[model samples]
Target: MSLSGKEGGCDCGAVRFRIEAEPVVVNCCHCRQCQRQTGTAFAVNILVKPDAITVLQGDPAPHEHPTPSGAGQTNFRCSDCGTSVWSIYHAAGDGLRFVRAGALDDPHAVTPQVHIHTTDKVDWVAIPDDMPSYEGFYPGREIPAIMGEDNAKRFARAVGRG
Candidate 1:
């Protein structure tokens, strides 16, 4: 699916943004931290290059949260509604942003390409049998197989790995 030009915002419509390019990958993370932070079973994130996202309206506030790696992640959220819009993980540096999928105008416009941190997933939440799932983080070297050559290259270049 071409996510280019896709638009989304915070719950209160305070922060609006657009996706200028297709996403590198989509992930449904079931980590305990994600569950606690989102107050849900999981978090569906759209992984894209930082340049791909263009904020069109109100500025979202950045809040840092601790990560297992201890480097932490910063979540940009709507100040008015306190809705998380996107996040920058320290490990990934500033190259990428993980946009909250549920914040999109049409949440269904994209689908999870992979499931991660499944070891901590809620028992009631069932991932499709055919879906690519992992007990922890997805292997970075294998991203090309899942994202295809072009996107894998894009991702690599974005993270300074290419």
Candidate 2:
């Protein structure tokens, strides 16, 4: 979906942000870590460049958390309500950020292009056949096709991909 003027904030409105560009891709991660962190069946993340998001309000606190892979991620959360607004994985460093889809003003503006860690997905969850589902992470080579070509290129550049 187009993200020309997409905006969102914490539940308490302490922190607000705007997405300057279209997201590189959306993911529905069923990893156990994501489940425990979100306290849900899964988490939907919009992958985008860190600089692409413009903060229009208060600053959110960044907390370092460990993933199942042992690598870490820093979750930026609202200082007031403590809601997770976004996260930056160590693998991507500061170049990429995973914006919480539920934190968006219009959460439906973006949808998952792929479902990862499906093996750990809830038994009641049903995945659409139109979208690819992987027991683990999918290959980066196919990301360009899943996401728009323009967004994919921008993501590659941000993550230092050739």
Candidate 3:
């Protein structure tokens, strides 16, 4: 399903955005960093092409932080509300954006297809049996199986993996 027109914003509505293409993948990251950043059990991020997303309104502040790979990532948050809107991971490269799914107008618009960094997950957290869960980050090549052939091809091309 193409999510070409999906829109979202920060909590205070100071920032708004639109997604011009279908998401490449959806991830539920249970890493400690993710938990700390989200202040929750996990962080739900929707991966999409960089140019596919458009900021319709407001300015977002960027905060850089270190990732598990020792590489850093930058989170774009609302200037007013401090809600994380998206992130750019050094590993994911310049072509990808990890959008905060909860920032979408409909938080449930996208559902996570995979769970990553489960090795650091909280003991009380429960993962659905049907969804794939990895103890650590999964191989990038596995996108095809998780997001379908079309999305995988697009994602690969976007990330220079194709």
- Scored by lDDT, model 3 comes in at 0.87
User: Candidate 2 — which pairs collide?
Assistant: none
lDDT of 2 by residue, 1-162 (tens): 786579999999999999987777889999998898788999999888877899999998999998766779999999999989999988765788899988989998877889999999999999987888889877788777776688778777877874
Q: Candidate 3, residues 1-162: lDDT per residue as tens digits?
A: 445798999999999999998788889999998889888999999898888889999988999999868779999999888999999988767889999888888776777899999999999989999998899887766767887999888877877878
Better of 1 and 3 by TM-score: 1
The 10-residue segment with the lowest total lDDT in model 3: 138-147
Error of 1 at 154 (Å): 1.2
Worst 10 contiguous positions by lDDT, candidate 2: 142-151
lDDT of 1 by residue, 73-127 (tens): 9999999999999999888878999999888999989889889999999999999
List CA RMSD, all candidates. 1.0, 1.4, 1.4
lDDT of 3 at 57: 98
Error of 1 at 127 (Å): 1.1
Name the weakest run of 10 consecutive residues (lDDT summed) in model 1: 140-149
**After TM-score superposition, what is the CA distance of residue 89 in candidate 3 from its true location, in Å?**
0.7
Provide the TM-score for each candidate, comma-separated: 0.96, 0.93, 0.93
Q: Decide which is better by lDDT, 1 or 3.
A: 1
Candidate 2: where is the Cα deviation over 4 Å?
none
